[model samples]
Target: MLGPKIREIREQLGLSQKQLAGEDMTRSYISLIEKGRAVPSQRMLKIIAKRLNTPMEYFLGESTATDTDIGEAVLDKAKLYYKERNDRACIRMAHNVLTLTKDVLDQTEAYLLIMRSYNRLGEYRQALDNGEAAAFIVTRTGDRERIVQYYLEMGRAAFHSELFHAARKFYEQAYTYSSRLKYLQDEHIRALIYLGTTHLRLGNVDQGLEFYLKAEKEARMAGQPELYGEITLGLGKAYYMSEQDGHMQLSYDWTKKSVDSYKLARSESYVLALHNLAVIQLHMGQKKEALPLLGECAGIYDERNLPHKKASILEEISKIYLEERELQQAETVIKEALQLLELRDEGVLRAKLYRLLGLVFHEKDNSDEGYYFLRMSHDLLKRIHAEREADISHQILQLSKQKQKMEYDDYKSYIR
Candidate 1:
């Protein structure tokens, strides 16, 4: 029974007797064992079981699970780890599934899980590689749904990596595949929404709006409010990019609507939308309106324990104080943002904060202290190879030679 079972599984996995024998045993030995003309020793059995991803107990009649059952069991554990948000463990389990099964669908599932886990962990390169592997396997299965899913995941990974052209290609593939399947309306909507956002990011405002409008109609018919939120966000971006005189007002209104929808869905996107709305208000010279929105975002970041996000809000608030010539308030806010930045190595934001602090000191007529902070900012920017570092270095050298205070415009070159 064991000999026949081994041969059956090996054949099912598309392994020839010679390949199954490996280097540890001869092809003739494998043939003999399969024909029951010879028995495999314990050592050989261990190697065979490992290669076939089978439990040794099964060969000894201590277990009854089929080879496919074992592969599925491993896959299920990987899924469980993914659902628990244990990304590292999920990746490990998925890799185990990859080695244990030769089934195309099972292999595709394992690759998809690994890709998603890598994406969540911010390993976009790994996620993209795994997504590609899954796409190859999914193609062999001719599973249109799986093909669409893999394309979407690949698009997301590429988008996060800022490879917008690659992302657009992947999303286009997903859109094409999903359109052919009548039951994949939800996937079709998703592909459209992502395509719209990608086009907008690539500066194709008209194309983006066209895609968003199409997705909006589909989402409404599907009764998917969550997807509708994405459409509204895309519309906000489109309106903001419009050359019309009321573009800012249109952006504000659409962004505000998106914020409300995201809030109802209890999504983290709500905070981002609110932050964008506040920025628009500032651009429109409604500082009073922007302040309260920044305050709300700061509160949310505090509750979420996201120090970097909170620091960003503080930096924005301090800018308003600086513009108003409230030097003391600006100094205090800048210092608070600096303290938060110290908790992490945010080189760009840290440099900006230092530059701002230096400006505050220069305004107070403390030239020496102001120069010290400005020097620190310049050095940090150079270390990070910031694009404006060369310009800032020249300006700093001039300030050092003349022992003169820098004007507000001098620091404006310090692009965030």
Candidate 2:
């Protein structure tokens, strides 16, 4: 059988099924083929033949493709997988291509693709490992453009891995290299954005702002809404995180600009920007303005079926109502938030909501219901061993007396 022959050859070459399958196929599929339980397709058979260095005729009495043709075909398939965002498949196909070619440029391209695939999969260390190999081979080709791309990909991996220092270095190299290439304006600007974010992560606020401002100029010139939104968002964060004079106001202004830009770009980050703007308004004591923004965010979260986020907004709204001494409004919002919590395992939030409900009852002079809800909050926090459980317990003890105090004392001395 073809399966027997394929297995025989594979074993002779001392290649595992994984190595034989490469990037275009799966190890399990190879196992099935070797076991004679599944037949390999003509295209797949050709790949197997090329990998095993045997002509296709040996398996199917046909020889329509050469080794070089198979190598190019595999590489093309790798590119297709990459385009489709099937990163694992792309990595396998790229690995296969490496086996069929000795050309430094082709090997470097394979390594670069592998690095990018690993990055997409959130395997940053593997991405960096492939990146090192790509960088080493790319230097021999003397291709400055590929070098720029390599650094950019490496920077992205490092950035996501929280290796800010390494990310900054790679992004700087990419920016410097892309600056020398007239056609790489987009890459140059992207490098500037990366540098800004990396510097911000490293707590270099002024340096981050400088990079962001430079990228902002390029983004405005390009008239790209999404790019402008990204830069403005970074600017907002830079201002928000700063302790400089009027920083809060500047943060609000930049954040408002970012929200507008993101809305124009139809970006999904619009809701998040709205939330940030609302928080900034609250910090500025513009509670009136913050309420409407919070309502808008709550509505969006509800429509998006993000129960936790909607409940969080409701909790904030309830807190504001409590602050205004609108007991009825606060109770209504708290009950709504509690209803949202019914299906969730969010013990912390549930406990907080119960505690708020207790406060509302206490404020209304309903001591019986107030202590009941407070005890409910305390029990939940204790069950979860939450960090604030002891504080809640102390508060409960202070608010209750006699029988209630004795019951809590027993719980504290025994259960605790």
Score candidate 2 by TM-score against the native.
Answer: 0.56
Q: Given candidate 2, what's the lDDT at residue 87? A: 98
Q: Candidate 2: where is the Cα deviation over 4 Å?
A: 1-69, 291-416
Candidates in order have lDDT scores of 0.77, 0.76
lDDT of 2 at 287: 91
Candidate 2, run of 10 with poorest lDDT? 407-416
Tens-place lDDT digits, model 1, residues 132-241: 66665666544566678888889999887767778999999999878846677888889999998887766567788888888877777665556676778888877776
lDDT of 2: 0.76
lDDT of 1 at 107: 76
Q: Which digits, one per residue and each the tens of the lDDT, describe model 2 over residues 210-243?
A: 9988988877878887778888888887787666
| Residue pairs clashing, model 2 | 23-92, 23-93
